[model samples]
Target: MKRGVEEIVPGTPPKSEEEVIEARASFRKQYRFPPENNNLTAAQTRKVRLIYEIDITLSEQIDALSQLAKLNLAIRNILPPETWESVASIPDLSSQQVSLKVLDSLYAVRNNLSRSGELARRETRRTDRNLDLATRSYERAEKQRMDFEDRTGAEDSNSSIVTDRETAALASQAAEEKLALRRLQSRLAQAELALVDNKIERFQPFLADHRLRVIFSPEHVQEQIGAFSAKEADLEKSLLASQEQFDQLTPNAPVSTGLVAAEVTPGETVRQLAQSYGRDAAHARVSLNQSWINHLNIQRQFYGHRVDFYQNKIKRRQMSEITRELDLEIQRLESETDYLRNRMAQARQDAVRIGDQFAGTTGISPQLIQSLQDAAQEIVETLRMEALSTESTLSRLRNFNDELLNRTSGYTWHEIQAILGDRLPLAWNYQLFILNDRAFRVSTLFWVVFLVVIGFFFARYISRTAGSLLTSKAHLAPGVSAAYEKLVLYLLVVVICILIFNLFNFSLTSLTVVSGVLALAVGFGSQEVLKNFISGIILLIERPVHKGDLIEMDGRILKVESIGLRSTQVLDFDNSQKIVPNSLLLENVITNWTLSDNILRSTIPVGVAYGSPTRKTAEVLLEATRSTEGVLASPEPFALFSDFGDSALGFTIYFWTNTADRLKISSEARHRIAEALATENIAISFPQHDVHLDSLNPIRVELSRQS
Candidate 1:
């Protein structure tokens, strides 16, 4: 093949001065006021100036009249005089030929009129401001022209300067005239707007007079029902169409590599093919997103219309049978609306997943990926708007239903039951499917959360009440009461979990599979937690180191406050609470102060001088134990001469007390012993040592006295 050569093109030449001038003149001729012709003689310039002034004035008038005509037509179309007159003349809607549809039309007309009036007033104000500025400019220009004429009289020689002043004055005058015309147009629009409003005002009182009658009329109610039903059907059809389109739109398929290899493919050709494929794929995705957004919007409109239809049905609930039917419809609508909300959420998620999968593929540039993301963002915004619209419509319907329910007392228990069921589906009867082959709903999840929260508090209250009853009525030990309470709570939790699983319709086989997977995960990643959990179960069953037991661990005395599944809470002597893991408590050595009984023997060691009366000191120690509070009386406090030291005799006081305050008891015993020893004139010993000097020579003793 011969090599191909690139073609080169020559650039265009620049325009000549005369051509440039002609182009500029043509452009200026298109505008309202063409630029001044400097080449003209003084007479021609004066004639052209006069003709331009007259043309501007005529154009201004034409524009003003055209604007006023358009405004009048718009107001007339928005609210026809016949419709307004018919509404105004009819005092009783039931007696007149007007239907609810006609009233609704009038309502729309009033809204349009109000909006038009407001917009007209705003335009009038804007025109007034512009006219003020234009009037000032014209006055200034005219004054300057007059001053120039006064200084240089009619016989002045400088005709050019005088011409310039006259031209300035004419231009300013033209601007003033245009603004004056705009002001007139704005005034005429306001006048027309007020006429429509006055017509609407006449109907306003009639509307108020027949408001209740219009609302309760069976014919009008049926009309609303039919209209809403038709709207819903139309939206449903459109939604189905959009969904079909979205489903049919698939991403561009990849080119066959075998076919490409069989053909003689150039690198540039392959690149172009790849680029086209990527662009087609991206475009397909954007179209799919747009289609899906349209589908969601239509689906949302259907939901809103259905809700409105059901709410409108409530107005005709005069009979018991009809009221019951209306209630069922309301419940069905609520459930359907909830289902739609969840489906929309799932659809949004699916769209995102599709975009993510596309983004991960090769042969796609960053720009293509960014474009896909932007499309997805637009889809999100569309969905958000649809949701807001649905919410607003549904909120109004719900409020209206609630107000009707409150105002009427004809509703039976079935109606109340239906309303409550609609408001709160706590019975878990409503089934909303999220995933195919499995029925799940956002409302179900919400109910689960609500029930769990309420159940949690309820369980806590029941457990505490049971614990109190076991402690007070049955006279059970605190540890036993706590263990029973915890067992009750855990059982309740297990029951809640089972109920939740049942709500999901999970089979035993599925739960077993899930359990096996969780067990494997626990064995690998949660050994400590598993160990602690099992240890806690053992502790709860075995009742070791239970609540209200005073125990010493890690050289610190602590009181057991509560026992939990994975950890035990204990209060230290310093009044701070600490959490000790169940496994740690099981493995570490702990000293239980009151394991079998609340009473425990505590000893206090005291030393006295090689004394005159050791027996007296013993009696005093025993009396001290008797005097101190929280010291048990049945065990019989006693003192023993336990040991002898180099300078004093060691005495120990032994006593039994149920009180966990060992520090307070011991301190009190020591104080009593010292006071009694002092009162009996028995000396307490301090550390004393005797020193001996041994030397071969005679030892000399010297005593020094200070004056």
Candidate 2:
């Protein structure tokens, strides 16, 4: 080897100066190696080598630790911190092995921040837009407020004007009232003056009569005296005529000569001749005289003796005179009586005539004269009042006519009269007469046409309306339609019969009264039946119940099968039909199932064994309810463990169904529950009895011994 410029030292090798420089350069180079080189000694590097090794190892650990820290941070970001410990303890490579993990996390964070920022910006923009819209709305509202204020001001002004108009109207009314009051006062004063004038005029006749009271006299006594003297002269003339007739009759009677001869013989006494004459005469005369005297005596005795005769004659004469006077008095009395009787008869006739006259004139009795007089007086007063009123009206009319004439000054009264005269005849004979004739013809035609038209319309209306009503499903219940139709036909026929009778001018009023009385009798006799009849009519009119309805009455639910006039038939839930009186139905309270639209609710209760998990049982029941056919789903089924029982839990499962056949649905639900219970091995308990025999052998022995 070539000896280099080396200085040998004790226990040390020496190198040339160039070698040292190179070694130094190499050391420097090694020390100055790039960060990627990692060329360091394991030792003899001032522990820098160990330190470097350690640092290298530590760098890996540090990287791993840093990655774990980052992973912890990432986990903290992804999940809650409390979850980190549990997750970190899991056997897996730390985050250091995971390349790009931090980068991904950073990117995720950045993206999230960016999205959040964008959302914030959009929200800010939306807020600004809303603020702008609110500002515009406020402006519009302000404009509306201003417009409302203007309208309010105008309304106030209009109101003020209206108030002023009302005030002016009130003032005008007050002024008119004052003027009317003045006019009334003036009219009262004028009426008072007129009344005074009328009273003064009425008293004028009385005053004139009083002035002429002393100028009256009487003159009638001379006529009475002359009439009495004429009566006395006629009486004297009749008496003289009676005396002259009596003298003439007395001169014509026969003479008596024996009385004179007897007077001459009594003075002379010629003895013998006188004696002989006397004897002869006496004998002859005595014989004749005796017979005559006897006859006369007998006659006188038959009549009475001479003195007694004279007395009797005097008595008879006196009696005749008395009788004649009595006759005269009786005749006078009879004449007076006759006169009185004739006067009474005349008076009675006059009274009868007066009654007849009263009857003929006023068709009433004379006893009602006071009432008649009062009526006449009232009529007279009324007439006087009417006359006064007519005069007033005439005055008013005259004033009105004068005012009209003065105002117009065009037509003269003669011109008016001429115009009236010219129009009167034409109006009376031509226009009015022709119109009357035409009206009579029109009225006849109208009555004829109206009767015909109304009859036809009434017939048709009755037929159609009754037919429609009887045929309607609602009116004619299920089984009674035929009967109702017959009833309707009968009613129509009866109505037609009545109408025909009316057409013939029969007195339907009397007939109707009789019919009403008959109806009353029938109604009283059959109140329940008549009530049913009336109730049927009310049912038809009011339509409270109809066919095919479900109703509950008298604690029985049934379907309406037939509604007859007398009775309503119903098919009960048991499928048996029953007939009920219409009156009874109407009079009693009833529940109509279909009245509130055919909706019904049905409830079913169930129980499950206790200690079988109440929640689980409820869930099962709800499931069963939901699965049941015909159960409503939108409302959902619910189950409730209502109570705990001794051996089971009481539960209620509620569901809804719209099936028309409720019985079938209920049966099916029960079957389904039974099947489900069987499949789930669930026990269903029943009321039961258990018996025990403590000593079967003793009982058997005792039975054997008894046998």
Candidate 3:
């Protein structure tokens, strides 16, 4: 309550001039650096742990040297001089220059580690200074916050003394505002009643004096009616123009309402917001209409009575003045009514727009909608809490005001002091209110929903772009590209989800509960999808087959088209695409002809007629293979005489091709070999049968008897 220049800021501890200087001197005490302290710091702890290990290593080397010494002494007599000299070199090996140098280095390191704990302490001085700065800044901010609370009753007050003062000030202010607002209302009421014509008992005396009375002349009455009609017409025109401009308040109104609760202008007090309510003209007009509608009716009756009195009493003196006042009052009331209607319409329209925004139909995001909803709920709860808190505060304030107003009362100032010491009752429910809740402020749910939406598109774009780049520029195999692309996409998704979970303010214990529930619900249904997903990752990493690589699995020769997250697409020899689940690929044995390299080693088996020269047949087969297109010449095609068949000699040609599609190359090679064999007069043999008929003449005589 008392404001003045003191030794310290408000809400800070008071200190004398001498005490302040002493405090400064204490802070400035010169640091006498301690003598070389050997106490080990934290960083050396790891090195110190190796102490026993280093001792064991040294002990092992010592034992090895001792054994060598015994061996040298025992063999010295039997050995040749050169051999004895070699034995003497054992000591030299132990004392070699390189060995001494390494030992000296280790010794130096040990000494340094032992003596340099002081240096470690010196290195931490900067950290201590930084901590000191942080502490001082924290104290300063705390003092500032306390000062703010003392002056404004903003921060939660603990000390009864500070709480009492702040509560007393707030109570007094709320009372003062309520009183002024009420007084203003009373004065406005009197002004409206006076402005009305019906409450004219005081004016009846003047009218009762026959001399002051005005006569009702027919010509003047007719002119008054015409003038009043013209005024009404002008006022109607003004009201229409005012209604058109009434929407000016619409833009600023929504902005103020839409702001998040914590973002109010700094240093705002409860009193300031209360004062603004009366400043709104539309609100004031609406209040006046609702509170004094009866007065308005009375005013209407007064206007009628005065006009009737003028007509009856034949009054002539001040008839025009009374009529003019009635005309102005009627016009003002009509304009206010029209303006209020227009303002209400604008308010309704703005409400609808805000509602649409909240419902996510106005292109405003749901997070923004949630933020707006939270802000509004916080405001409502805050207002409700304040209302509950003010009931007791207001009651105490009114009692105090009444006590102050008493003259020669038994309630002395000592008793008043005693009464002020007692604090108002607590608003117990305010503590339970959600206005200051951290859950609303954390915006966890909003960000989770938002990140998930963004992560999906981001993962998709990266996967697609990676696949295209690897296939076109990097020239990776189709399956490899597909594998890598999908791999990166899935990894990105997992990383984002993990980061989102880690960033959540709420404990993941709750998330675990939710996830457990979901897992239980989805366990059976999602098993296949889960299996395929894991298998796809395996397929990508292991790369049993790449896209465009010919693979034979389960007796089907299929070429891999692409690898996906759940399924791998392949093309049959008939050029039809087949989607095979990734699980199938991992479960079955797949023969990837070109997984490692593109060159496929093709083997073709051919047969030649029996009794044909084996050397000639082998030479013919080799020449045919060499003539085949798409076959590598550097490997030197070789023909293996595999077996001697019943009717022919079988030979197999082995060769390699650079062509990726081995099927095409194999077919072309077959065509080339056929032409080459025919040109060389080495006919390809087929299974044949020859019958010997040396004893068949007796069977023909038996067949003629049956005829």
Candidate 4:
């Protein structure tokens, strides 16, 4: 069947009566769209299905959970002051558990209020519709009554017929609807209040504890540790130096019988008795120094150990939690301190043995030798005591940790979860997807970009396949082959970009509005990128610069290796890769040596001593160019008398060669030219200055190099 307007042939008017009849008869339907049924009935309102789809499929539930996880992370990151980051003090598990139970009640109340709010909304809608129907019924009845009275005379019409009982019923119905709406709205208001108040009440205790901890917590235990460590280091260094000096003293050497320590047996002038003792006097002096150093070591060890005690206190700051990690750390410290104690005992035994040897050989007083040995023994003893005390402290800390863990472990799992703060429980932290919280909600755009990247690499594979086919089956220069592949890839990119832009610009919105904003953004945000793209397009089309062309820009010569969409990679003389923006080559004055053709003219300036024949030198230089490789034979090499320098006549040798690395080829030709010149007895020269001296003014001389 033909639909009327759709089947009507374009530009075909009904030229006859029969055609008009046929057209009229064939008026058939082309489309039937869905019907609008927006009005909800009372039954539907009463049975309001939950808007949140709790009975979703497993996959959909997982998706919802994933979104909730993202929301949780965003809340954690953006609301740190409200979370554990701002928590100053941790409350006991029991206290925290009590607060959490209260919070659970509050959540239950909130959920109930939420359900009631939905019910009240439905009731309001039902009552509103009832009121509308009643108003319409009243108007219709009034109209009928009025028309009935107009037929008869108004004076003869009965009050019961015109002003019927329906009027009072309509008024009562409207009043009832108004009262029901008010009651529902009032209940909703109270629910909202009760929900908010319960939330504040539940969280008040945690916030109060956090605030107190933040205010009163120790801030810089690290600084105090540093100060105590400095004193400890000074005392340790002094003790080590004393031990070294004591060990270095020679045993069995002469005691000093001089003014040193003033113990020379009341000598006739204290220095004269020391001369008599000879080596004995020197040994006596060393013994006195060793004894004094040992006395200082004992004092140093006592104070240093005290500093160590204070440092241990500093290290123990803010670790009140009984975590598995703390237990491991305490055990590690215990083993290390035990090892330190054994090392200290070994050092003390060596010191005691040396002290006894000095007392026996040098015949020093037993008391003085005993002092040295006692100081060493005392330091080792102090270290051992400190080690024992640390071990005891560690044991106590472990007991404390065990007790706390047991207390927390006695609670229900959910209660323990409360003490761990508000991270999502392990059950819900599924790594279904990685999150970039900065653009949390716009993850779809990120997916699009990620997919586009995969597509971009796929596009490259296609380009490379096409390129490889060309290289294997067809003969093309490397440069042309590369250009072909890049051209195909760039075309794909341009098409894809346009398609993506149009998809956004024209779908679900006005094309003109989106295009205007897009144009403005591109113009302002990526104008340079756009310029480079356009410049690259021009270079590709114009062929003024092609891959493998040797060109110079900004006084540096580089060979074009690859032409990208926005930039070109070039290899310089040193074979170093340099990336130049497409716009840079297009906009600047670049010299393209291999642009027009690969045949290029190269010049090498030459100079011979002032007396050398310019023409002969030219012949020699030109002849040398003939033997050099890569030089064009058709356009034969030529030389010219170019300049007259201070002491040399300069000549220029010119040659045409197929383009190559400019420096390499030019260097070869120049070497040949110099050899040709040397063989001809024409010398390449340096500039020389002549001086004339006047006897009276004697060439004013500086002692530096003179010509």
Candidate 5:
């Protein structure tokens, strides 16, 4: 099955033995590889396929290595040193080395152009493929239309045929437009590539000459100043042209062409146009303002660079001539920035004029004014983002320049900072809100924060003062005073919140959504809590049980300690604090001893021996009750002989006292009654019992001792 190399490979036949040997050697060089075999076994086919796969992989590896080499060369030609800090010792040499930094930027631009070109090429191929497919589809549609035209059909069928023909024609038109768009894109890519090439061709020569002058002859650097000045002049001219364009430009209102005046009312049409006009004008105005700010910052940076460059030249004569043109370049930047500032102001005025056009016009709708305000708000938000970005860029630039100045100059850090405008006021005047053309700025944020902090203390003070008045002057119950204080505090807090919302131009109506969410939450899970809160409010208002009032609930005696919104605090008989839900008090049957008054009636019972002196026992009981502390003398103590028992005559006494001290009064009364009964020889009795045994159990009484 083995074939000669000349048979397997497509090449001239080897005429001599040496040539055959060379061919065989080359074939075997690919290690187990076989050339194309049209008629071969399965094993030879596998070997050929494997050889093809290896060829593709090797080709890709070679391409990757070539790209890597190109990148390495670029780095070597344009990259700065790995250690920038160490370069400060040899400033001239370092500047001369990094003088090609401009070339790096140029190379980046070229790389972008190349990537764009590659994409354009891919788009071209894809569009060409699509065009081919579309052409085939159009041909198919046309053939269908012609066949339908040749057929004899009903009237309805003829209409369908006409429709089919129109569809075919439309498809053809679309294909033509697609091809045209592709051609235009290809031309655009070519033009961009040419522009990049031209810039490189023009700038690279100048860079090379400047580098040579810095390296070989530093004295002839003054001659190159004229060339740099000419370049600056060119840049100035370009800046002027751009400013002119910016000034002349007006953003067209984005009104839809489909909005027909006949379809809508005259007012509606005007409203739509007004909305678009206001938005467009506002966008233009914000854009101009942002550009002006950016230009101002750039001018400041140029001024710093210029001063640094001049200071370096004054301090050291050995500065590299390559960077000498940087001073003129910075001057040019400053001049261009000034020009931008003037033109941006003009553009801003024009935008204002457009935005205010409806102000003096008759029959202006309120909706139009509202739309203008809304557009201004949108631009305010956009400006906020732009301002933050500009602020970050300025800070980074300042830091970088400050560090560079520190490393390369004899100036102190503070001096460098001052030179970089570190002492300039911050952007606190930047508008954060635009309400009907009125601005609320970053300074307003400070006011809001101040108000919030001070409002907290102020609310507390007012609540405390109100609480004192309710407790002292009004003689209100403690729980009621606390409730009123809380209400006052919350009212103050709400007022402060409203003021804060007003500062941001937020309507309280917006809280309806928040209220809805809260209502949903309450309906789902807080029914019992809400019930308790309402019950607490009822308790405070109706004064059902005041603080220090004794009450018995669910067989336990408790004193009301404090009433709150959700629950009430009480002290049990054991003096332990307990939290009871307000709903429990309202729902459960509770006995309030001091609901009407604190006076409570308590009863004491006594038994005297065997009817010897029942009247005396009653007298003794009455005397003890009258002598007891906290017993109300106005509701005088009363005693009576009630029931006759087997051992003694039972007597009862009743007394009135403060409900809170009832238990203590009863205890003290019992002690006094016992002492008085003993003094009167009226013996208090105990239970007596008599037993009878009918059997002979009492006859024999014996005692036995166990061993």
Candidate 6:
């Protein structure tokens, strides 16, 4: 028992004798010992004495009792004393309970330690993953920053080189300008000398001609000048009279004086009298003779009393010489003006050429130079802003690159190559890094042009295919067959073009953004063009009217010719073609005669005297329509007694004709009706009214008074 208690406590020693005695008495009621024959035997006492010695206390009895007491106290502390006695009644509880309590404490401690270890392992793994991802992100960012820095540095170098070249070119241009100014001064001096020489050479000849004209044949010159002036005056008067007659005469009126004279002549045939006028007898004699007579009469009435006819003739002759001299002087002045104009034009061209050269040397655009300098100022401002932005970005990139280089200084080129192998070819990696150090503008331009060429060819192919498809007329409704086919082809081409753009790596999202901006610009810039495009699409889809339909739009009756993307062409009633914007047709109301069906009804109205039978007239008109070649027979021609006028009965001949032959059928039918009416002895009415008057009582009263 002592050994068992020792096992529970492990290395703990036994308690004192006084404590044992008290313990035995306290535990006696709660604890039980093994049953014997009624009392303790000598062997059991000896065994108890041996257990007490092994327990290592001052008195064996006291030690055994103290151990029992300690066990009782332990039990009472753990459980109620009443339950403890029941629990301890079972054998070996002191040892078993102590062992179980030790095991429970050990298991609790082990579980806590294991949980702590697991938490530490998870935290380590999480930390390692975070560090790795951060390292990769930092490395990628560093590479991008280095690339940007290298590009910026190269651009700065190029800009500096361009500036140096521009400065040198400007200096050269200044020198050239100075030399050109000196040459212009020398040429002006030479021109002044040449003008003086020319004046001296021409002066003597001019004086000689003036002297001869004044001295020799003065009277003859005067007579010739007077005769020429009189003839010119007569011609002017005739011309004025002819113009006045033309203005006063109607288009259908007689135009010749000779024709009028023939009409008035007695016992002369009209043809013979007319032939006596001129070879162009019909035109010369028809109406102009009357005009000439009226003009002569007006002149005699207005100016005959003021001057003698012969004296007036002499005055006009003198005026002719003066007019001739004045004309000569005017001609000379005009020649001089023409020469001056040509010289001025040449000077302007020279100035323009010089200005263009100056612009080229200075790397300035001529249009910008001519824009009053405002554009140049704006360009300079823009450049300054761009430079500042570029400089700031370059500095940031440089700083980032420096940080990257410091962090990765220990890494080898092979290590970088390995990391970036997936993105770039292994052989090209070194080349790419070296090329990144200088300007890569040439390579960028080459790629840009390559992409543009690809896009251009793709667009061309789509446009050609679409144009061919639209022009074909295979698949469409009967009413809008031609137009619908064309529209489908056009839409397909556009869709294919958009798909080709997508194939070239252009995203719909980016295209949408660009289209939105362009739409805003177009809305503000060209509203009419936008309206036409939208209207054209609507017209193609709705097909309210179509090609070949007879329609009237904007008061113009025409046959639809062609419907294009932007405009519609129509042939008018007069056979003239007009191109109308699609927007106008879509927005305005139009009359379509053959939209639904090709058969059209045309009406021809005729009036006969009221004495004629209305039924007979209707029958004659219908017979006339039936005989017409283009009139339709299935619907059968008919006529109606439409109305009764004051002098005549109005009848309308109704006939059906194909829309294409509507005009021809109407015209022919009218002609046939006129012939039929003539055969029937029915007279056509004219606009005529008769008035009757009566005199009442006055005549009879006057006669009675006279008798």
lDDT winner: 1
**Per-residue lDDT of 432-509 in model 4, one digit per residue for the tens?**
432322222244455557756876887788888877887788976566667778777877766666666454442423
Q: What's the count of clashing pairs in each model shown?
A: 0, 0, 9, 8, 0, 12
- Pairs clashing within candidate 5: none
Instruction: Give residue 460's error in model 4 in angstroms.
Output: 0.6
Of 2 and 5, the candidate ahead on TM-score is 5
Sort all candidates by lDDT, best to worst: 1, 5, 4, 3, 6, 2
lDDT of each: 0.63, 0.46, 0.53, 0.54, 0.59, 0.51
TM-score of 4: 0.36
lDDT of 2 by residue, 523-588 (tens): 789888888988877665565677667888878778887667778888988889898888877788
lDDT of 3: 0.53
Best by TM-score: 1
Q: Cα deviation of 472 in candidate 4 (Å)?
A: 5.3
lDDT of 1 by residue, 1-707 (tens): 11111111123322333543454354346543564677987754864675476455555565555555565455445453445554455444445444444454455555566667688678657766766776776678667767767776777667676576556555555655555555555455455555555556655655444333433356665665676567657656655665565556554446542234535433433444444444543444444444444444444444344334334543334434433544655565466457546755864684576455554555566665555555555555554545544444444344334434543646545567777877666545456653435666666677778888888888889999999999999998888899989988888888887886677676566556668999999989999998999888888888877789989898988899988899999998889999999998889898888778887889988888885588888887788778988788888888899888887898988998765576788788778778877888888888898999888999788999999
* Model 5 spans > 4 angstroms off: 1-460, 470-487, 490-500, 573-575, 642-648, 659-661, 694-707
Q: What's the ranking of the predictions by TM-score, best on top?
A: 1, 4, 5, 3, 6, 2
Per-model TM-score on C-alpha atoms: 0.39, 0.29, 0.35, 0.36, 0.36, 0.34
User: Of 3 and 6, which scores higher on lDDT?
Assistant: 3
Q: Write the per-residue lDDT of candidate 6 for residues 237-319, one digit (tens) a residue.
A: 75566456445543432333222353443223222222322222222222233333433333332222112221222233433
Residue-wise C-alpha lDDT for candidate 5, range 1-707, written one tens digit per residue = 21222232234421333443454355347444546678955544554554554444343333433443343343234323223232323334434433322332333343444556576556546655665665675567556655655673434455545555444443444444334333333333333333334434444454344333323233333444454456456656655654554556555546553434456654565576666655554554556454545545554444444335433432333332323444444455455445545654554554465456545555667767666556555544444444444443443343334334433556545455665574334556767866444576778777878888899789989998999999999997675677677667767988997888787776767668778999999999999999998897788777777777788998888888877779989998887999999999889898998777779888888888885676666777887889888888988889988888887788889889877667888899999999998998878899998797788555877899999
Scored by lDDT, model 1 comes in at: 0.63
Write the residue-wise lDDT of candidate 3 on 1-707 in tens digits.
Answer: 11122211123322333543443344234211121226854333322333323333333333433443343333232332223232234332233122222222332332333334344344335444544554554455455545655665655455654444433433333333233333322322322222222212222232223212334445654675575566556645644554444434342332233433565541231222222321243333333333233333433344344446434431323344544554554455455545545655554554455555345344445554544444334333333333333332333222222222331234435445555564322221123312223343334445677998799789989998999999999998777887788788888898878777666644456567678978986796788988998898788898886777878888887888888879989998888899999998888787887778767688999888887777877787787777767778977779889998988889898988874656677888788878877887878899998997787457544435555
Q: Residue 572 error for model 3, in Å?
A: 1.5
Better of 1 and 4 by TM-score: 1
Stretches of candidate 2 above 4 Å error?
A: 1-501, 504-507, 573-575, 633-638, 642-647, 657-659, 688-706
Estimate the Cα RMSD of every predicted model relative to the unseen true structure.
26.7, 69.8, 45.1, 47.4, 30.8, 64.7
